[model samples]
Target: MKQDIHPDFKKVVFLDTSTGFKFLSGSTQGSDETIEWEDGNTYPLLKVEISSDSHPFYTGKQKLADAGGRIDKFKKKYNLD
Candidate 1:
């Protein structure tokens, strides 16, 4: 393996922007922002729109799509039985 050819994989804090949830994980992504974690250590801050903390599936609040309605609409649009 070549040296210095890979991205710097380090610990980064992923903040859920919507829910304000934060967690520490390793990533190769870089950020200009820094955040002091609960451990009193500063790490790169990566803001994400959604995370498992606030995701619909994880929270069990996902809305069931109206598949029947969509099928009926499609059939009507194309005049298919």
Candidate 2:
């Protein structure tokens, strides 16, 4: 409720390079670059390496973390048959 003490929240675009996706949202995040949006206004453009679209969980392409058949190695070591 105070004036000049809060950050200006405005609509900005987040660009995901991995998936070439652009999203418009509001935030107080800072950026050094500006971009012209669809509304004929300029806002800070934030570039991110990953987002929901490119993430493994969202795309259902997650890779198992096991290295060199760790599950089989463990079973063999313990003689679990």
lDDT for model 1, please.
0.87
Cα-based lDDT at residue 70, candidate 2: 80
Write down the RMSD of candidate 1 (Cα, Å): 7.8
Identify the runs in model 1 with alpha carbons over 4 angstroms from their true place.
62-81
Q: Which residue pairs overlap in candidate 1's backbone? A: none
Question: Each candidate: what lDDT?
Answer: 0.87, 0.81
Once fitted onto the true fold, the runs of candidate 2 whose alpha carbons sit more than 4 angstroms away are 1-5, 62-81
Give per-model TM-scores: 0.70, 0.61
Question: Taking the tens digit of each residue's C-alpha lDDT, what string does model 2 give over 1-81?
Answer: 778998889788998766678888999997889989888888899998777877797888963444457888999999986
Model 2, poorest ten-residue lDDT window?
Answer: 62-71
For model 1, residues 1-81, the per-residue Cα lDDT tens digits are 889998889999999876779999999998999999999999999998778987898988863344338878998899998
